[model samples]
Target: MKFLFIAPRFHNNQYYWVKSLTDHNHEVRFWVWRKEPLENYSALTPSLIPRSSFGLPKILSCYREMKALDPDIVVVRDPRSFLFVFVSMLIARMQKRKVFIYSQTPLYQTMSWVKKITVRLMLRFFGSLWITPIIGDMRYPKFHPRAFYVPFAIEPQAQEKSPVRRPIRIISVGKIYQERKNHLLLLEAFYDSLKKSDIRLTIIGALSGNSPEYFNKMRVYIKKYDLEQTVEIKTNLEHNEVLREYAKHDLFVLPSSNEPLAYSPLEAMGAGLPVICSDTNGFRWYVKDGENGYIFKSEDVSDLKDKVSLAIPRLQEMSKNSLNSVKQFYTPKSFYEKFMEAVQSV
Candidate 1:
């Protein structure tokens, strides 16, 4: 089957999916809104339509491209790409083909009425929906059957046995979103629990330019609490650099709340690092508590500290379990099989 995927950007996880599907004898093409400089995704050579160039010309270009490809299925991966997907859906309908929405957006009851109406109309006319299974209490009232659970896949890396560091290196990766990622919470927990111990906490990711105030606040907190030495903040590392960082770390921590199946933890698992995350995160579904990883209460510093302290002593066993779990459940081949089944059913 020929599948055309439209996304805001071609991420490493999406690249794995494209490679997996093509390897399985399916023709896969991609159209990305923009390309990130740090991402190593030139292998696919996806067609690019810059986000700034989203006008009538781009819309017509997308329509013409879809008509030319005449794909068996069109998969839209970004909710923000509604105009592009709508064009693809129109072309698909005219060709008697199918369109599917692969979304990470949670359809919670508290969602705005406008978004609810928009989703309803899309499901009514576009095609079936595939969403992460871990979205919390979020349901499409009228499109439950059309929605299928599709987990993200990771390319596993070969395990390298290394001596564990005495300082118990821990790493967290995410944008510096003050309220959403809750990095401050993780910092507080780390400072309260592991400060005296010989442990190092590194928070790595891009600092959102839009949230400079929050970023500055974090810096101030790091200084005021004298966590300057204990905690390190690294920003804007390349994709390969991130993997190297993950390799050096003993544990992965994500203290974010309301996440819809984050890919970083899965990548960490692929690198054989045990995960410590908030229970509210959607990806917590993959974590078998006390087995591969531990889930702490969201925003609860005491509980997070307790879970971190408990997991510190058993990192080796948990790390092994983490590697084995990803190998068993999160491979690209497994994801491809499931994706094929879902597409066929649709």
Candidate 2:
């Protein structure tokens, strides 16, 4: 089947989804708001089409491309790019083509009544909605009547069983939208949790452009709490380097106060490290408290500290569970099949 994907950036999550469909013998085409140099990431090829920066040019280009492809399915990734995607789908529909959206976010963070009604109206036309949650408990927009939960998947790796816990190395991975993910609380919890233990923390991810103030604020707190040695703050690393960090670490923590479903924890699990995340949708699904990993209160430092302390002792068992869980549920093959199921349903 031919599939067309429109997203803000053709990297990371969007790239993964597109690649999954393509590998499954489905033709996948993408048009994004902008394109980075191909060298910015791996597994990205020359096939993904480029579109306008935004506005009318992007809408026209996307519609024109979709019309040319006449795909079996048209999927939009980012909500911000939905304006063009909606128009493209309407144009595609005019040609009797099916349209859908595959996303992890809702229409709004907390929808006002009017916005809720608007979303209900908007969703009515979507043929399918695909979401990947760490957990499957999210209350997605109404158009999700045909919604499918296809959790994030990771490439397989050799799993080394931890026989006994030694130094407790902790790692946090993902784009550093610290406030959205509540990295400040994580920094605080990491500092407090390590006070009586031999654990160390390393944060690996790109800080969002809007987070300079938060980064500076975190710096002040790190200095004040003397956590410079305990918590190492760094910038973007290659995906494998991030995986290496996961292998080196005993625990992975992402205190996203409000997360739909995050991909990092699943990747960490693939590396055989136990995860601790907020009690959000994604965490609720995979983390079975003592089974695979721990789930702390979304924004509560005390709860995060408590859960971290609980997880430290069972590090070996949790690591094993983490790897086992990922193998069972979050593989690329499974994701591809699940996605195809959704699209075929459309």
Candidate 3:
């Protein structure tokens, strides 16, 4: 089947999906709306209307492009977002083309009234618009009937032998978002729980997040608490290098609240690292408590600390479980098969 994706950027796990589909001889094409200078996939050309452009030009330009490609399915990244999604949906509605909303799990509870009305209207225009959520949470469909699970797949790189790294390195990989990632919570948990213990935290942040103050606060806490040597901060490393850092770590902890979907924990599990994430992570379903990892309360320093402390001793056992879960649950084949099923099942 020929598939055309309208997304913000063509970087990250989008690479793996594109590669997988093309390898299977499925004609795949994408139109991106932003610039990713890190790696140029030349075919991932910019849309006629750049994301920065506003008003009718954005809609017309995207609609024209959608009409031109005329793929079997139009995959809009999200239904809630501006620009691309509305335009794509408009074109799909006009052209009578099938739309598979490539999406994160919808947080229906916290949605604003305007957004709720907009999303419902979009769904109304196209009856039973299939939603392919990256987060594999079945509860989502209970909230919205059309949501179907199409989890993000990554190439597994489980360490051959679980090497016991000393000082117990813990890594938190995400863009620095004060309102989003909750890096401060992770830091506080580290200081309160394992300050005197032989454990180290390595925070690797992604670029493009507008939260410099949050990053600065982390430094202040480290200095004020005299945790200069105990905490390490690195930012904007290459994708492969980030994967390498995963191998050097003992556990993955995501202390964020209301995270839509985080790919880092999946990648960490793929690398055979156990996870300790907050309850609010949209992808928490993947982290099996006491098996692969434990889930703590969101923003609860005490619970976070307790989970971390509990995770320290069972790292080796949980590492194996994480790898096993990745093999069974998160494979390239599974992703492709489910994607095909989602499109064809209708």
Candidate 4:
């Protein structure tokens, strides 16, 4: 069967899902709201095609193009992405085709009344399936009639990590955004941990173009404590290169409070590294407290630091648990099966 995917962007994990479908002997054509790839992300193959215009023109242009492509099933990223959803659903239903809405809607966030009504109306008439990547209870607020969950797939590593190294290297990957990514909060917690134990931290992410204020602030804080040797900050590593860096560390921490879903923690878990993330991470379920890793209270420096201390001794055990936990569910084979089930169910 032919599947057409339209999304705002082709994120790293997004590529894996598409790859899953293609590997299962299906044809897929991916489209995006923009033509260019993200700052540090690239498509796996058969590059993403961008929508041509804005407003009605975009809907019409894409509607015409999708009709031309003539897919067996149309899969869109989000219901909120009206152009893609609207056109895909309308056109697909017109041809008696099926639609899958890849709605990674966060349970933490509430939908506006206008959007709620709009989405319900679309699903009611056009008959689309609501598919989400975010798993566990943190998914959208149990609203969709036929909602299906598909955890984002990853290529997990088979190698297990060595025993925890002193100066237990903890790594966090995200953009340097103080308000969202919470780099400063992590730095403060890491600094507090330093007084008690010998631990090292390596931060990896992309940077804003110029006047990287948050990056500079983190640098200043490191300078203030003379921690340049222990706490290393790296920027602009490719996705695969980031995985190589993950192999060098024993722990993964994503301190962001408002992350809808993060790929880093999942990727780290897939690589046999124990993960510690904030309570609010949408994929927080992947980190089983006291088993695979810990989940600290959001923005609590002491709590975050304490979890790190607790994890130090059992890092290897948790590493095994992390591998056991993630590999069972978040694999490409799992995605292919689940996606096909959703398609057949509809």
lDDT of 2 by residue, 1-346 (tens): 8877666566564546656776777887666656543223555443444445543545555557667777887776644346655666566666676666566654223547885565456556544454443334346443335556666778757756656555678888766645676778787777756666777888877765655777777788888988777888777676566667777778888888666677778878888888888876455567778788888767788988888888878888888888888787778877887777766675
By lDDT rank, best first, the candidates go: 4, 1, 3, 2
**TM per prediction:** 0.86, 0.84, 0.87, 0.89
Question: With candidate 3 superimposed using the best TM-score fit, by how many Å does residue 121's alpha carbon deviate from the native?
Answer: 4.9
Q: Using lDDT as the measure, which candidate wins?
A: 4
lDDT of 1 by residue, 1-346 (tens): 8988877778776767888887878888888766765665644778775333335325555666777888888887745555655555676676777778887754333556786677777777766665543434445442345666566777777774365868889999887745678888888888764558889889887765676877787899999989888888988788778878888899899999977667789889989888988877888878989988899998898999899888888899898898888788888876877777777786
> All candidates' lDDT scores?
0.76, 0.68, 0.74, 0.77
Q: Model 4 segments beyond 4 Å from truth?
A: 35-43, 46-60, 81-89, 94-96, 106-119, 138-142
TM-score ranking, high to low: 4, 3, 1, 2
- Which ten-residue region of model 2 has the weakest summed lDDT? 37-46
**Which candidate ranks first by TM-score, i.e. highest?**
4
The better-scoring model by lDDT among 2 and 3 is 3
| Candidate 4 lDDT tens digits, 168-269 | 888999887455889888889888675556888899987867649989889899999888878999887777788889889988988999777888888898
Deviation from native of the Cα of residue 86 in model 1, angstroms: 2.9
What is the C-alpha local distance difference test score of candidate 2?
0.68
Please give, for residues 1-346, the per-residue lDDT of candidate 3 as tens digits: 7788777777576766776788789888777666554433533443434443333435665667767777888787775675656676677778888877766754333456786676677667853455544445444333355656676777777454366677888999987635478888888778854567888889987655655777788789889998888888898887778888998888999888888777889889988889988888876877889999999998799998889888888898889998888888787877888777777776
Question: How many residue pairs collide in each prediction?
Answer: 0, 4, 0, 0
Q: Which residue pairs overlap in candidate 2's backbone?
A: 134-282, 135-281, 135-282, 135-285
